[model samples]
Target chain A: MLDTAFEALKTFDWGSDLAALAPIEEAATASHGKPEARQDLENRLIAALKGTLTRDAQDYICRKLANVGTAAAVPTLAGLLLNKGNSHMSRFALEQIPAAEADQALRDALPKVSGDLKVGVISSIGARRDSAAVPALSSLLSDSDPAVARAAILALGAIGSVESAAALQTALRAAGDRRATMIDAVLKCAESLLASNQVATASSIYKAFTDESQPRIVRLAATRGLLACASQPAVRSI
Target chain B: MSVIKKPTRRDFMKTTGAAFGVPYAITSAALGNSERPAASDRIVMGGIGIGNMGRGDQGAFLGRKDVQYVALSDVREEVRDKSKANVDRHYNNGDCKVYNDFRELLARTDIDAVHVATPDHWHAIMVIEACRNGKDVYCQKPETLTLREGPLMIAAARRYGRVVSGGSQRVLEDYRKYVAPAWAGEFGKIKSINVNVGPLPQLCNLPGETKSEAIDWDLWLGPAPWAPYNPKRCSGSFSINGASWRSFSDYSGGGMTDWGAHHFGGATFICDVRDQQPFEVNYFDDSNGKYLAYRYQNGLTIYHNKPKTDQLLIEGTPGEKLAPKPVPGYKGEGGIYGDFIECVKTREKPFRDIESAVNTAALAHLGNIAYQLKRSLKWDSVKQEFVGDAEANRMTDRARREPWQL
Candidate 1:
């Protein structure tokens, strides 16, 4: 049955009977609940990616890999990162693989990919909250492609570390395009910072935005953010 | 081919509201306050299980310019058609997406949030899936059919960082807002509360299977154990006035949890039972040998008997006390609906958040176990279990049917 499902995965396409791929779904389910079973399935999925397959079939495998894949599957997924046809699905799996190797693969691909592919990989790095990618992502803030630059700032903010914050602050002071986008990213970083109990760091970012000198809406959000931070229990010493 | 254009509940709300002089609201969908957001700022919304309360709540959401109900989903084709028409009627362009399954609605990246008004059995799965799909959730109460689902529901919301609130409709579900001064000493001291809701019903042993093209019975029973479908059992007849599934313990805690979610939520608010339970629940069997009343640690007794006025009575220690004027702002007609939409925009938690449904939901389950035991039971509110009583504890979590396992 499993072999039949894998065979179906080899030629899987949109608008087909999904139940025919039930064994794949079953394996993904089994892998989610049991660590040992997931390892076995994960290895098999990675190896399957190495063999020839249709784009949709590779996608089906990637979709399942998003749930069960680890660092061992990272290289195969990363191989698809710059492929125009497969980058989105590849990044989808890598963004969630729960391994530094997956993050590094995405960060490593950032310079190698271009256009929309570059933008998608940069966004995946943010979704992973990969702070180590901050230096690489920070450099893209001045990229010729505004979309790529926007993705970099957003990803850096999602990383939400003091270093990422500093990079964003420097970018905000200097960037000519998408100033609103930068503010949105800064606020996102502020929120992530607050969730981590970096109240002082978050408060500084909020204070910078709350300056009556800033936009009224930005000031309003910053004001609320400051109050929300104040309302919680006192921040613990770092 | 039959489409229910307007649910019977819409008319029921008007008749019931006017007769009782209560604010069971269904205003025109065009009125907007100064606080109403701009068109682009409007939250894109969808409804899952647009049946009774779901449709009612969706109507209220349609009233707000800050919300756009872009899609409707339900297991029943009739329900989908009806809800699509309802939403289409509100939007001039009359373009509203419809799906037979909720997962399809979740897959719509355009959907910013979802209203999960599925049955007690389907609530957890639908809401959890919605949360994972990055949609804020406005789910109907009781939060889960059983106790174990409480923590899992909360964990899902927290993990995904989505704002989720239960449809306890605190503003409309109970007497808390209406009788505020009662707890604030206008009534001296609330000695006991006669919560006017029926006792738990026996297992659903409805005679025959109800098969019809109007509803997909299998989908309606998602997460609930496979059962023979009866019209009285599947999707429920809106003409019947209340969900019949509430009478079956397999899907609900009967009318106790149905109305218990309302009354208990109100009682706890009035009694200040936050972070604690009754510590005791004893049902003195009625003439039919059914558990009928219970007491709490605060000497506040709650009787399961129906009230003369269809409202719970908060009895004072000495004598009759004046029920002060109902709070005006607090009892906004369909305010909970607006509250969830407001939370989605502000990224804030609703006043009566999903977590607020936990204790009252727990009360409903505990009350059922006590009724089944046909005796008084001691409760451990903190641990959320029966003290030294494994039998009662086992009743807290029911076995989930396939693909619905938490």
Candidate 2:
């Protein structure tokens, strides 16, 4: 019963039969109890990933693809990295892919994805803690949207990149009250980077946050960040 | 019946009004108003199940100058005596009465209202009888044992013109200030209502016990279908041994009907979906057998489990978290009792009024019916019956033993 359902899902062009796919999706997640049944479902999902379909269908297939968690979908998801048209689906798919494949895809996508979509993709990559995507994510700290810039700064912190610290410091200098949330993000990222032995990067982030002319809360958070980093006697000595 | 020694006036005031901040001068002023009934003119109050919950209800009425504690009754003699003493200790007028049987207490013309705090199965009969005898009722949550009995209870309340309220206090307290705004698109087309009532503890088997003199074995069983007098069933000592009599088919409809009445009642009330049954209902019992989920037509999924969470989570489109913040006063056991009394005086329907609570009870009953039949059964809320499922229909209402008809 499971094999037939999976086969039906694979061969059926979701462009024409989008409604019918829901049951198949439900059955895939439903308690099938057998490992062979799940594998059959995954194979059908992989087949669906290869097909051309509407955005909704692609989104649905992408979700199933992620759920299947196969190495095969990595290439398909990676192909969408440079393709901004379905970047959300691509980012979602990339996030679910194993770190080795996802990191490269996210790094490639970061330069190409502009605006809100770029921020989303960078955040997704950062959330996965793929250090390879750090350079791309760090570049976003200077993006147009304060939200996106904040997200990028936080992503850099998560990745703990020394190269990203200088960018965060520059972003912090220009950021006034208009980007308090973003500034907090940069301070946090710098703290994480410092903990990873990237002290020069952390010190620059700390200085930016502690600038007295900045918002009182931001300065306090920055001071707190310095204290946290300084708590390590070896780092304090420096 | 043994006459219990009563506390003095000072002790009585200390016991009852210690937490009530109203000074005697203000109380006297409030009582002096011509509109307010005198203590002697106030309605006499009696409690049937004066256990933990029952005593709490009794205490609320005890504070009201418009009510006098007249009688106390419980099958458990200890609860009855203790409750009677508690009432006397507060009133200190030596005018209170006590009875082991609730019927004798209800028959007294002095008592104007009865708070039915017995287990779920006993609610219908007690409430209906109370109404028939011209007594207003405040029955605890999940107001009926089964779906069929809810409408009958509603009919009894309406037919008798007696004010009846379900013990779900969230129904009162600025719920409209929270729910109405959400329903009016303030929350931007509610995507889903996730009601998590936490998880129930593991069921335990009953242990061997020596029957104590405090309990009445036969009377405690009451209208429930005949079973041997097990001390574990009555004393709740078997709770740790996984022998939850209430969780079983014969005793109670598990936690779904028990807690679902309170949690699901809040969800449906907030959604303003009203008495219409869901277009589709899917129930899922948790893998651990400790929880049950019921998804309704409005995309609201109610989870009835043990450790009740944020009573109801009303979710919507991005950036809109517009469900009413749960009011502090609308929580725990006493919350409902206080709300019911205020509504009774104001002549306003409470948050868990009979009409809405009946709908909640109906939903819980349908979930149980679906589980018991081991197949999904479509419900007609208007007609209040299973669509074409005759076997499922039989479970709607149980037969009352001789002379207990509604």
Can you write out model 2's per-residue Cα lDDT over B308-337, one digit (the tens) per residue? 445566666766655454432332234666
**CAPRI-style quality class for the chain A–B interface of candidate 1:** incorrect
Candidate 1 reference-contact recovery: 0.00
Q: After superposition, how far is residue B101 of candidate 2 from its true place, in Å?
A: 1.7
Q: Is the docking of candidate 2 incorrect, acceptable, medium or high quality?
A: incorrect
Model 2 chain B weakest lDDT span, ten residues long: B198-207
Whole-model lDDT per candidate: 0.70, 0.60
Model 1 stretches astray by more than 4 angstroms: A1-238, B1-37, B168-178, B207-210, B238-243, B274-276, B286-299, B306-311, B317-334
Q: Give the distance in Å from residue A202's predicted Cα in candidate 2 to where it truly belongs.
A: 85
Two-chain complex of model 2, DockQ on C-alpha atoms against the true structure: 0.01
TM-score of each: 0.55, 0.51
lDDT of 2 by residue, A4-87 (tens): 554445544312344455556455545234567667666666666677654545555665555444465677777755554456
